[model samples]
Target: MRKCRFAPGGIYHIYNRGVDKREVFISESDYIRFLCSLYRFNDIAPTSNLHRIAYDVRGLTSNISDKPDKRKRLVNILYYALRPNHFHMTLQELIEKGIEKFMQKIGTGYTMYFNKKNKRSGALFQGTFKAIAIESERYLMEISRYIHLNPLKNIEPEFREKGVENIDKAKDFLLHYKWSSFLDYVSIKNFPLLINNEIHKGYFKDASQHKDFVFEGLFEVKPRTCKGIL
Candidate 1:
């Protein structure tokens, strides 16, 4: 586990996978539980039972991000995509050490949930989550598209190397995939209460524009592979 240098206002791409490259999320409920942690554990305060907490709104985000601190947040979850074995997130630290604290909570909380559900007692994830700072807007824009395009690998196993075979098919899959925040970012509102979309929204003219930006990358862009820490 690398000791990540998290500073206030810095944006980074953080990712981790299951231990031994195993599947961490084996079912739908498993994925949703982790997603709930993304909402339930962002606060500076400690809490549990994500199954009950995600629905409360808790006023953590209150639909007003980047505002005066009514609720102190550890980090701003700009974007995220949850794969079967791994997960990816683009985050901006709201306070110093925010990312580190947030990741620890998420890792610990989700491991407990997963282990209990499966009747296993062991670490679920690999080493500490790895982070890479998004140093430029170009990288941010590219990473946003890159993250959204991740589902395409399920459809076209070699899409990144061979390029998308059918752009229409690619769009259709992404339009329906609910695990990622891609739908919400594109005005679909799959999970409105789950993420703070404002920071990334500022990069685009509108949700339609954001959707367009991601769609265009299917055939035109070949971003570097976003690998798991495991």
Candidate 2:
């Protein structure tokens, strides 16, 4: 196993791409499955195989008595974005070794589901995920802006380099983008269950302020020049 210097109560930007730059998410279902894994696999307790559980309970109507116990989360997922070939997350360790344990579960659980669905795989991710410690408040806010604006690459590939062509169009695109936590940050309630908003609350006054922060930084924020740090 790769050793990580993740510390308790520390924030880190975590990311990984697919093997050989392959597409890890081939379709909408693949994205949904991965999102479900993100929600289901953060527990400190061992869980039954998610794929198996879903299959076993297929077509069954749930009774009112089937409520499961609340999960003890390993880490606090501040924000996340899923792309076709890669993904990014802003996470804070909640306990000792929380980030490592959470990543292990996410990588292992999602790989099994993805490989089985695609019917061919040695490894889905390139290798161990990369992490960069957020050492300052300014750095944390900048990284958050970067992660949120990442989807603009799909529409405006040069936005990061030269700035957005049409800020209005870019903002609209981000507002409707479904694969990232951008919507949640903007108070759209897309995937509120997947994130812990305590950290974000301390940074932005509210959703409107958060949206303003993202848009206002478009001109000043430069493209990430370093590898494995965004």
Candidate 3:
């Protein structure tokens, strides 16, 4: 079946798994590299040496800017999480077809780096990746929570099998988890290029409200409830 196309300005749950469900991150460094690539591609850092040439000067100079000499460009990173074999992200597109370009850059850039590092051939991901547009503001928040909770299913399966007294502590483990955007959301660790602070803050109109939502969602649902999404 043909997959759906991502629309500009739409919030999508974008994800991909390793081929054969194998471990994509063999070491902690691999995870860091992958996350760095996300920020790098999203224009998170000041244009890299090459990016400065490709998209900044030569690349954009041809495209006329809407504001006099200023070139028109749109791209931003919203939220993302990294796991062993898979990853998830919530993105807001700023330009027409920006999502397509962004994903292509990330995929191609990471694959080259991963293959060279591991001395492996072929693709790292299973396929072209999947994206589901978040239909409501409610789902937007819900899915973000879901993405952050993915690592729990992998690292702390016991929290689900046996009831833990300190559910807050279990959730705290997630807060400190460096592999996902959970840290970014809480502002404990800042990943400047990985996410757009302005757009991300908009997800939580009230900090207390968002925290309650995440906490309640964690406890109310059986921990095993995440099996499917993971």
* Model 1 segments more than 4 A misplaced: 1-4, 51-70, 224-230
RMSD of each: 4.0, 3.9, 7.0
Could you give candidate 3's per-residue lDDT for residues 67-174 as a string of tens digits? 242323345566677888888887887777777777887788777767887899998888887877777877777777777666776656554445445777777877
Residue 19, model 2: Cα distance from true site in angstroms: 1.0
For model 3 the local lDDT of residue 89 reads 82
Q: Please state the error at residue 160 of candidate 2 in Å.
A: 0.6
lDDT score, residue 191, model 1?
64
User: What is the per-residue lDDT of model 2 for residues 61-97, given as tens digits with 9 covering 90 to 100?
Assistant: 2321145638888888888888888999999998898
Number of residue pairs clashing in candidate 2, backbone atoms closer than 3 angstroms, sequence gap of 3 or more or interchain: 0
Taking all chains together, the TM-score of candidate 2 against the true structure is 0.88
| Number of backbone-clashing residue pairs for each candidate, in the order shown | 0, 0, 0
For every model shown, what is its TM-score relative to the native structure? Answer: 0.86, 0.88, 0.76
Predict model 3's lDDT versus the native: 0.65
Model 3 TM-score on a 0 to 1 scale? 0.76
- Comparing candidate 2 with candidate 3, which one achieves the higher TM-score? 2
Cα error of candidate 3 at position 182, Å: 1.7
Alpha-carbon error at 108 in model 1, in Å?
Answer: 0.5
